[model samples]
Target: MSEAKGHPPVFAIHLTSSATDGTRVLAVGAEGPLSADLTDEVAELCRTADDPGRAGAVQVLPRPLRTPARVVVVGVGAADPAGWRAAGAAAVRAARSDEKLQVVVPPQTSPEAVRALAEGAWLAGYRYRDAPDGPRSAEVDLITDDAGHAPALDRARALAQAVWWARDLTNAPASIKNPPWFADQVVAEAATRPGLTVTVRGPDELAAEGFGGILAVGGGSATPPRLVELSWRPDGATRHVVLVGKGVTFDTGGISIKPRESMKLMRKDMGGAAAVLGATFAAADLGLPVRITTLAPLAENAVSGSAFRPGDVITHYDGTTSESTNSDAEGRLVLADALGYAVARLDPDVVVDVATLTGANAVALGKGMAALYSHDDDLAAALTAAGDAAGERMWRLPLPEDYLEYLHSDIADRHSSPARGAASVVAALYLREFLGDRVDRWAHLDMSAPSWADASDGDLTKGATGWGVRTLVAWLGALGR
Candidate 1:
């Protein structure tokens, strides 16, 4: 037990043999035998726990040895980076109090595994409630024999904090996170930051600037719509990247309306915007050398007399007209406007758009990964590699040229909703039209599946997953300093 009741826990990393003798928490993987330092009694108690070697399994008992007060053994089934993260996260959650915690770094743990363990613990520590709770308990320390891994752990902490920021934004209630409010947060971020500039355009400006997609979808809500642009350029940066996010704060399927059950989680429709915000902030904080521009078209898809209806025609920012065939297909409309604005205004070396755009994406890729569509193979490969490195999985789905016809509408340039078959790819194709031929290296991440997790696991809680933030940050970091 911790000596103090409310004091934040202290985290330290130590070699298994060097763990301090005191009342403490010892986190270890179940794959191996107990450390030789542990007394025979503690080892016997651990072996008594059935199937302790299974992933996510846990066994906690009073320390029979002269060391810590309690020993918590967590199962890192495969002893991989992901397994280590899950083990660390589960151990932190299972621990009863904020006490001095020491995690024994597995002898075979790679630097990446060390980072994962740190990130897992860091993320599990976050709790979002409206009440003014006091600060969280002490920090977690990683005990390792090698001192060289400290810098990597520091970097991981920063990245995990960025993810936490995104999760907070995404988890915010839609009533409090409307378009104007979301824009306000960007303005506030820019006000405090040094290298970032934020520009927000309201409904009047959006209409004047020909952002009909945003205006049309936002017309039903009293909150209006906004196009938020954030630009960050560090000194001596050569490469440029533009990121666009669909910020539908809440979606009710407009006039089409959604089933009651389907509408419950619509507040997370702004997950893409949250991700880009987090990634941009992370890049700025880390002092990455690549110039980055983030665009979020913020709106609410509500139902009212003014709501855009089926068969309505909308001219997007790039002068491409679209027919609103299904009001539920609103994400692509807002994203199309931002994507066009990025290509037309920024002229970056590459463009990427993230959106919780389609239910079909959940069906195509399941909940484990996002559906990735790219215009250029090199950019696609680079993003895939980045996602792999960041532990966010992406599956490349082709933007079949043949699917373009599904978007054709007799009254307008195209239809917002295409045929239901291959729906996710069709949505991506619709966005590609707005990019035009001028942009070569472009990619779309349909993040519906990965944007929110159904239950808490590993580094994620049961709300917004903040999935793309890490992947985007990793991609930018890999672009070189």
Candidate 2:
């Protein structure tokens, strides 16, 4: 419940052969470990406790034991990367009050498992607060005799840092996070990385460039809108991937209006942009051999006399016309301009856009998964595999050609938010119209459901989840390789 003024510290991780003089964490398998490399008293206590060893289950010893006074036992069901990740997260949460921890790495664990463990622990330890009483900083030591796992740990640390940065950006209050402010934050962050370059377009530039969709959606707010173009062009990079993110800093549904309850979490409407920025930063930090271009369209959809209304026909960046059927569907409108620009200017091998575009995504997939739509099977499969590896699961939805008729508008080339049912699909179809002939290279992620968590889960806190970051980072890493 406490707040902190600045970013929280990332967990300090080290590789060691034995437990440090602090909290010692032991892992238990689903069937119970046949032999645990632990003190006799600790092992006996674990047995007497009757722990089931299910993934994410944690148990803390009641009494202090030896050099490492505190002891915590976590469950790693099936002993896979997912299980190890869950176990690592559970152990860290159980001993969150402790400043130091020694986590026992299972014997002969693969580098993937080690990376998962480090990522889980680092991510679980993240807290966004503005007071001195917030979550305390902690350091973790992965107890293992092998030195080869160090590289994996390093990669995990970088990925975790990227996710944490996304969470911070998404969780920031809307009052202080307008479009220009968001652009400033991203520009400042990109300045620190040597390989990244950021160019921000303000209201004047947007209007001059004929980005009507972005201008229309942002007209209601006094602060105006911004389009941030972030690029990372590494030498000798072969593939160019363009990422577009919807950055509705706060959405009041803009004249269509959301319920008061729905507006409570509108601050996180920029979650997609946060994820894009995070992935781009991660690529630079990890020195990935891929040319990456990120387009973030930022605006605040607030209610005012100047707000664009339903039935208004607006021209987009590529001269395409769209009739707004519902102002609440503003995310897709802004994204249309960015996608149009990406297709027109950036000649990339792949284009992926992430957005919290529809509430129907939550209705269909619930809060733990995102809805993925793509015409390209290879890209879909690649993203699905990356999500599986990164713990950010996504379900690919069918983009039926028959649904294209639903977007038919009498006044314009397309209708934004044309149909009521299959809302997520309709939104995806609307955005697809902007991709031009590059439709096969485009993929859309409606991450509304998973972008913000209502409850704390493994590697996810209750607020902004930073959902797409890990998946995007994983996919980019694979592409670079």
Candidate 3:
């Protein structure tokens, strides 16, 4: 409808047309003559182009054109469907360069598949390389079969920006992302958006509220701790969604100190928190008319004599006692406390807590996907769909009723971890206990696998991915007008 902030909507967001000037399409194909639609779109695009080269390399291009927006033909080479998706992402990046032209969508496949590629393109096209002014921005035109494309494109744009926000919040060094500092970032970021009310609960306030789990997690760190909440409510909002994110700035495994390599990526331990915060940024950005409240439980589980020991017993905010079986499991503690607080305070219609919670999840799902565990089948399916559309993979794991026995403790209400293997299952079951009997719609996401990349992949950039944000955002987007 309008340009981001400035520019007179310089490019019309359009589907692939034969014209390439003010309108252009991102094209890809097998090494053969262009398809009829592809050829026509390229021809039209070339007319708008001053240089045929910038027209956009995709399926193919015209030799010359009237205008200067050169053609860009993205080479699909010989890849299957997934290859096309990657090629589309590459096309978006290529088009963004050297000019401010609108790149059109050329979805030759299913709408969802094309949207997946577009999501990837929007994601890969991001350049967080900070300019003194900030990162450069580009305009994208989605070639769609449907008439109503602007709203969908806008939603995708919001989701992409939110992913970047999640990555930045995760990528910022531990020195820059401490608990209080993180809370401040949340306040400043959330305050800028309309209809968002920000609240910060300090350590004293947490203690007063019986948030022993959070207090225990953050007590060792010099940075103190906080619970930052961002809420958006329209009149008579139909759904209440509460998201609890683990905000451990860094994790040292506390008394159960991890190896040097394990601690290396600890700075990203709060990747889950960043995702929710980033999603909050998107929510505020899009002004989605849903009652979304995000709780970021901030902490740094450092190692000092003051650090909670492995043998220590913790009294949680819900008045449940937990015997710490392994100090590395501290993420669940902070998240448990946050979840407890969220369920108690908001009593939301649906509650979700995202965290880089367990290593077993990584072992189960690998780095490409996160494990999604929920009591509600509908919520699980919704999250799975969101993950696919957003290009984040999530596998729904069963929260078996029998698995509850592992978390039981002889001395306390629960043991911090299960006695045997399959730690991921045990971890999810442990969290289920914290939600208590009333909340039936709760789900836990173990983001350990997808949040951090071994390196950059097809569409993912190196470091923090802000994994669950898009899915959560998309699910929320589906809820309201």
Candidate 4:
């Protein structure tokens, strides 16, 4: 955890294949480097090596150029973010088990490539490593010649650190990351920064203020529920943006319990809250000018006698009634309350909510992409552009005004979920009811797919991918421009 300070060192890259100390990594694209740049020995090795550069390709040799003890050449086809990230991560795997290494930045490397390289190397090296004897790797160094790249490198490292922070929180066990603990962490973070204000509301206050969704779902657990509101307002900032995250510390599906197999990874159900919180921290770290507020509705959906039941009707913060036809559809319930509170109280110029709400999102976009649904085209475009720049791919899904009919309820205003297909779209539609014309610049990110990964790829580790944070931070940074 102490390694969270900064990025591993990277040095300025040179074209010559001279040997150096420790492990040295070289970047090779589809079109291999110029023949003149390689030493005679290294050039001969390249000829003997299988296909110099293809996507995700790597070739390792023992002192080919006679400088370093070992050398690795990684393929980065097309030099896109994914390719660069893979190359950086591949370098981590190719290095000595416990040695510090240097990575050679390719000539004419784009800013995005730099970010991908830093993010991949740093994230791949992350470990819970709380114990003294846990496996650890030396710092990674990126070689860069231009002093102009320093600022951008610093920003990239900060963003990667924030992602790592979120990943740690998401990977934590539910026993230690309950609602109160989560609130305390949020408060502790806010205390460290100026111009930031944090407010926590407990179960009693939530009940008094009519946050029925949070209360009902949290009632089943002894840990209770909490609402954390964080605001950062710098002087002269006129535009305000609100980010709402669904903080279900652990989800058991309440009265409509999930199967044993499906409940195993429920600890990551709060990935949305962690992601937005990470973005807030990143924005503060970068000193962005736009005002930002993050709302986290913290709760645990457990099974108990008092657990809310299907077919129960609850009144939300916006005075809208929703019937819980399926208790498993609880993420939207908490998010609805936060969305209403943000629009009614903060009146932000833009609103974006993140949640691991539905499996349908994974069914549609798979685990590598997040589903983005929005009513505002401009807002959607901006977010997509920001996501592209940050290497977080978000695919837009239609809200389908016609799909609103699926949420119809016989006894209440709407149903928590639809009975049949289009579950992801229906969930987004359910949240839209809370906006009620007060907010137009809004986007809902269903992070069920990209929130966690089964295996490590690029800079993302095997668990808690830290999905939405980078995209939101990038978007917030681009707000004024």
Candidate that would win on TM-score: 2
- lDDT of each residue in 419-439, candidate 2, tens digit only: 558899989998989888899
Clashes of each: 11, 7, 37, 13
Worst lDDT 10-window in candidate 3: 8-17
lDDT of 3 by residue, 1-481 (tens): 3234443322222222233576644333221223465456655654564433322224334334323224454533333334445655656555534444444444344454455555666776665644547653445655454555556556666778778777777887887779998888788777677788889999889988888888888888888989888888866778888888888899988888899988988889889888887887787777777788998888899888678887688988878889987888898888788777776767788888898888889888888889989878888888888778666888988877877778878889888876688788888888887776535798888988889877655567667777888877777777765
Model 1 bad stretches (over 4 Å): 1-57, 64-67, 75-80, 97-100, 105-111, 132-139, 143-150
Error of 3 at 2 (Å): 20
Better of 1 and 3 by TM-score: 1
Better of 1 and 2 by TM-score: 2
Ranking by lDDT: 2, 1, 4, 3
Residue 87, candidate 1: C-alpha displacement in angstroms = 3.2
Backbone clash pairs for candidate 2 read 3-129, 3-130, 3-131, 4-129, 4-130, 4-131, 5-130
Tell me which of candidates 1 and 3 scores higher on lDDT: 1
State how far residue 50 of model 4 sits from its true place (Å): 4.5
* CA lDDT, candidate 1, residue 158: 74
Pick out the ten consecutive residues of candidate 2 with the lowest summed lDDT.
Answer: 9-18
lDDT of 4 by residue, 28-106 (tens): 3312222343345444555665555454556765643334445567666556776777677777766654456677775
Candidate 4 stretches with Cα past 4 Å from truth are: 1-38, 64-67, 80-82, 106-113, 129-138
**TM-score, one value per model:** 0.88, 0.90, 0.80, 0.89
* Candidate No. with top lDDT: 2
* Candidate 1 lowest-lDDT run of ten: 10-19
